[model samples]
Target: MVQQRSVTYVNNTTPLSITTKELDLENCVNDNQVAIKIHSAALNPVDSVISHAANKWLVGSSLKTVGMDYAGVLVKRGKNVDPKFQIGDKVNGFISHAFGDQGSYSDYLIIDPSKQSAIGHMNNFDYLDDDVKARFSDFDINASYPLVFGTAYDGLFSNGQLLNSRSRILVNGASTAVSQCLIQIAKKHLNVETVVGICNSKSFEYNKKAGFDHLIAYDESNCLEKVQSIIKDKFNGQKFDLIFDSVGTSEFFPIIDTILKPRAEGSLYTTVAGSNKLKYTGGLKEYVSVLPLWNYAASWNPRRHYNYTYTMVWPKPAIMELASLMVSKKQFIPPLDSVYPFEEFQTAMDKLNTNQAKGKIILEINKDY
Candidate 1:
């Protein structure tokens, strides 16, 4: 057993508490434990969201760790871990297993074998390659991209019922990580008939390069009307087949309702509204599904959409498959705003909390990694 330094939230709100403790390297049963020599980790808005509101959900528990994504080399493994992964293999994963202690805000962390995303095949140490080692060095950034993509991909293809060469696709908050993934996947991979991105006018050009064939600025008094006019000019008065709204504010819904094609076979995917609130309106068939990243089993919002919500649990098998595919196609790229050494963890958290970083923030734990 080795002692691992970790970050924890002692109180329900504000200010953080970082500390260290002993973590067992063994004693893993049924493959419920994994020891990671954390090389790097990323911060998501959910951290702040949970920290501020988790007080209500508390059962008088004092321990709370806030982190969802981590990437590193496997230092130790519990028996029954996917048999294909071994010590020293590079991996990246999202932690959605039962919530508290399993979070990734630590020097070393454990992920139940069921929640890991395997990036490479394991081999006897002697047979590993320079490229694989080099690849592992960037796991932090590499792993973050998948979480964004998995959310967008699963939401679109599965929940939204989007298919290849379908009608126009509208993506609100197009410049976001999830939207970026949607743009690329919808345009370059799926080849939708039209890909439109809606955002502030200032970011229109940026959204264009990210994959939106058409960019709409929703800042005007008649922004919805403007969007409708643009679609008419472009698609000969056609309606959108799918709409993905990453920003869930109330304003977005009216815009979606106004521009969404009436009675068209399509859906509106929103990350802001949790799957529990998945709803429909105006005789428009909108499929709403939540982003389930914990269990592999697909559950539903139990709403009208009846969306088969499957958890994108970073299971080793799915992770390896997606990673290998991305590597083969050269798509495992992380959009990094900056990287901070492990010692600057507080600084990193501050930047993230302020919403100052435009892209993912990476924290390097080990100097050599």
Candidate 2:
């Protein structure tokens, strides 16, 4: 029996449960599956948060393994695998095996395209234009981006229904990875008029360089006054058309009307970090539950006064293609917070949980690749 090294949760309730272990890999890939030799994988706050509360969602089976984003070489493929995928192609994307039984934090990962796993996407970024590529200078960008980029894409286009020239967005927790992706996409691709970011003093300059037209220091006194002033001075007093919250706090809700446009203007405020401190919302018998769409459902209720929702990123091969294309076109490059070796996930998670990463956090899974 063949075995491979992987990051697995010995139990579901603590980051301490996360550790590297070897597991049997014989027959891991079915005839329709593909296996990737992971060069790099990304760590998201969601990855760590879920583990502490994972048991509630894990069925009676001892579901292990954890991680989502990865980029690497397609080392093996089942005979019936899609013809578009070749054995030696560079592939990258996400796999959500019931929140993670077959995760990306491994030397190798096998995924089946036909099944729905939490949020799934698997594709290759053919970075063909080396001549023009800048910050996308390495393959690791592929691993660092997918999950957060997808979240931003879905938030702005799908949920926010962002009206290009007219939309003005305020990114709460703007220094977070997903918010960084938002800054790039909204300012560059969508050409939104005014993009503002709310972050602490240390990140003000970085957020500005990331394309936020204005940055407010949330740590400063009268942060709300600063927000109102920016709107009055830069945007003609128009309230934000969309507010993307990564901080996961309800503190802004009470003052919602002061910052966000009314629900009638087709405005929205969506958050991923709802109730940041996590506890299991499920029980022992629960087998599967996707990111709760109940929050999204609430947004559609006629009597609901606020247009808000909790969003979960979805798979769109187009997003992968777009990131590659933009980088090749010399448009903009995705930024990185830091890269850790495969052995240092705990340190990475510690940094992530603090919510202060300067950019995306990635694991250098196989440095040689």
Please give, for residues 1-369, the per-residue lDDT of candidate 1 as tens digits: 777776676544435567777766665334655677776777765554555444534425566676767777888887777776688887676665333765666777666666455334321222224554454445555545555656666656655475678668777677677677667667666678788877878887777667678887866567666668877787887767676666543344445555665433545433433333222211111222333332113233333331223323233445446544654565444455667776677787788766435567766766555
Per-residue lDDT tens digits of candidate 2, residues 30-121? 79887777888988766765565566444444656778888888767788876777777887777654455777888888886544222223
Q: What is the Cα root-mean-square deviation between model 2 and the actual structure?
A: 4.8
Residue pairs whose backbone atoms clash in candidate 2: none
Which stretches of candidate 1 lie above 4 Å from their native place? 26-32, 56-59, 97-99, 115-137, 252-258, 272-320
Give the Cα lDDT of each candidate.
0.59, 0.71
Model 2: residues >4 Å from true position, as ranges?
A: 13-27, 56-63, 97-99, 114-137, 275-298
Tell me the deviation in Å of residue 265 in model 2.
2.3
On TM-score, the candidate that comes out on top is: 2
Q: How accurate is candidate 2 locally (lDDT)?
A: 0.71
